[model samples]
Target: MSSTLKVGILGYGYATATFHAPLINAVPGLKLVAISSSNATKVHADWPQLQVCSTPEELIARTDIDLVVIPTPNETHHALAVKALTAGKHVVVDKPFTLDTAEAHDLIAHADAAQKLLSVFHNRRWVADFLTVQKLLASGQLGRITHFESHFDRFRPEVRQRWREGAGLGSGLWYDLGPHLLDQAICLFGMPQTIYVDRVLQRDGALADDWFHAVLGYGELRMILHASMLVAHESPRFIIHGTKGSYTKEGIDPQEDALKAGVRPDAKDWGVDETMGRLDVMRGTWMQHSQVANERGDYTRYYAAIRDAILHGAPNPVPATEALQVMQLLEAGMLSAREGRLIRLHH
Candidate 1:
């Protein structure tokens, strides 16, 4: 059963094209059997060997498919995942697990009942910069974290026609980038005490939100998640501070760009951030500043973990429950933004 984990993807959009397909094909035990896509030409061009189905129904129902990956629009995740899980196939839903926390809970219950593995594609947790921070925080080098900031900003002047930019529950910068930032926060610090958000359509004539700034409060420690389309000079990926020192990291993870450029995930020195982070730590009584060496951020680690969980029963890399917490934080942000008030998370 080593090579019997045939995986079927539920969409051929950017997420599937750039991330899921490439990463699935890269892993050893996972085989790309079929894909759900309307664009046969583009799908064929991307993978001539793989079978392309017109709809997700055809792909998820295949007897040979052991795993089903849904990288479709955020709104359709719950429905597709339910169908796949009920079909007795392991399910992988992309981030922002579902449009709402209720939908996420239902999916989790369905997956648990089906006894099939359910996971989310929370790939940002594998970033090299984040890994470094994890090491620092775990080592107690950053004593009593006071503030942490994570940004996923970009400069998109013209809001191209896309489902994410359209008017919907899962559309907007908050839904798009919020999951990534929040997942990272939850990984380090569990649920926050309060959530505050400021969401607006900053871009001229933009339909949905083009920018968002959220604050996750944990007593004295506050985590900031910010993203925008109008940022010409993108901010650092992470800005972290504690009682000991501050770590300001610049540059996004190279894996996504490398995938878009047709570079293999296992290429020479993959996931290595060329531009390292500036580390300021208290040495004795004074603070010393230096460049911290970055750990290689390999996204394939996620797929590998999935394979192990399916075949060898290893723990899931991004379990459904962890993704659920991210969903809860997202909903809290929405409530905060809608009411123009700070939403306190009891747990």
Candidate 2:
């Protein structure tokens, strides 16, 4: 248990640049010490205080680094995480934890054997809208939830020439955004009994699935997760219906754009969402509707929790076991889409 935990980030891509580095720097006990990337110009420009390692092996071998954060790509996550764990460093992997559950299991085993903390960066669990929904469900404001629909839509009409836009391992919108929705749903209502989805490559020249509409069955309750790259007009960020009434919220979380714009986690307006969700409650015969203020979101808590877990024996922020459930749902959804039928979850 170290008072100040030195951290080494394993990528310079969008995830590392936008979320991991900034959040880690903002956390009190976690220091953003080094980065592993062949292209160090961005790392130098953004965070000159850090050292740049040409290879991941070199970064992992550094004696000062206490935690290893992998934000490179979906395919490299498993290998890099395993190496770090075996090298006696705690690890954090960007979500869609690995290419498959097999890889995830092996990494978990390595972390357990090393007696180190292994966490997934499912940062969206702290999204403002999600926090609000969690509070509402817990408060019993939306009683007996029957239908839950969540959408992570975008307006990208053309595919870019990148690894994420291809049909390779861990590519496409589903593998990218699907974990967020699945993790959120599982957080709200345990695991579902069955899963169904329609995976589509909607954009022109798209090599991978750009759209997906998945339905998770929780007995009579229906939870839907949808994402598309072709949406131009606005849609509700969340549409939740229950026996009492329905709760609809428009506009996505403002944290992502803020983080990309160089806003630190401790900024004055950090985690503040200007857009609030609408809640409709039934009172006898009449329907009453009102705006529910969005809850403040804090991604720094993830890293803070990581620090505490290492220093104070607090629980892992996003434990490997919990993340494995998300991977199971992801694989089952893919199998359902491929077979054109509903796949029952045995675990």
Candidate 3:
């Protein structure tokens, strides 16, 4: 293997163009070498030097590529990742790792058999608000958190003609944004004991579910994860209440917006979020409120860790096992919604 891991992305869609390619290129020990896209011109318009393959199979078969990043649709992740792993390349699949836990397990097994690293792009873990929440929790300022609510709501009333909003197997708000919220929650609190979900199609012409509310129970703690397409008002991105205090944050991470605006990940203020979170805690006699500065988010760290894991045997940043757990929760959430009952997790 070369000192730099050559990467080939499986698609040229929004995720591939917005997050994966730019992040891979920004990392030091990784190279965005090739991309499989039908429209080579579109890929070349941004990365003129990249090798654009006509098909994912061709890209996976390349002898020079050491890593294949699958940022394609949720349904295609399993098959493409399997092919890449079988071809002896490290694989990174965008989140909602696969449609279900079964596919996630299959991919993990394939990577193990091929002696390759497998990772999922749960990049929200590096978001500024989430990072701040981690620090605040670790500091024990919130005491023992009893209630946590996370929202990824948007105001898109009109449904678009995209695969993500289609009635396909893996198309819905739950599969689209559920992985991110679930992964972040799981990171803060381990796997929940039970999960209950309510999924709905709120948009007028929506074919897939556009809104979802999920509740994950952890003993006495109740964690709520919600996303909707019809919310116009400002909603707290994160709200946590503990025995000693409470914390509330507003606004989503800025990295995605920056990336969408063609901002390079190497910029000085790459992941700097200006929105401060309000931390209210009891200090002796009275309650005090203070603004907590956010920690800088760096999605490039994920790819960099992937580079080190492949070349230097460092731990995988977002290992297949961790993502598989997220998949389990996603599947369980669906079952809960379908059966209208709380689903219990075994492990």
Candidate that would win on lDDT: 3
Instruction: Tell me the tens digit of each residue's lDDT in model 2 across 1-347.
Output: 46999999997988889999889889998888999999888789998878999999999999999999998779999999989999999999999899889998999999989999999999998889999999999988778999999999999997998788987889998899999999999999989999998998878899999999999999999999999999998888999999999999988898899988877887898899889889999888999989999999888888889999998999998999999999999999889999999998897
**Which residue runs does candidate 3 get wrong by more than 4 Å?**
none
Q: Candidate 2: where is the Cα deviation over 4 Å? A: none
Q: Which candidate do you rate higher for lDDT, 1 or 3? A: 3
TM-score for each candidate, following the candidate numbering: 0.98, 0.98, 0.99
lDDT of 3 by residue, 1-347 (tens): 87989999998999998999989998998888899999999999999999999999999999999999999988899999988999999999999899988898899899999999999999998889999999999999889999999999889999998899999989999999999999999999999999999999888999999999999999999999999999899799999999999999999999999999999987889899999999899999999999999999999889889999999999999999999999999999999999999999999
**What TM-score should be assigned to candidate 3?**
0.99
The per-residue C-alpha lDDT of model 1 at residue 347 equals 66
lDDT values of the candidates?
A: 0.90, 0.92, 0.93
lDDT of 1 at 12: 90
Q: Model 1, poorest ten-residue lDDT window?
A: 1-10
Better of 1 and 3 by TM-score: 3
- Write one digit per residue (lDDT tens) for candidate 1, span 80-184: 999999999999999889999899999999999999999999998887888988987888876889989988888898988999999976998888998998998
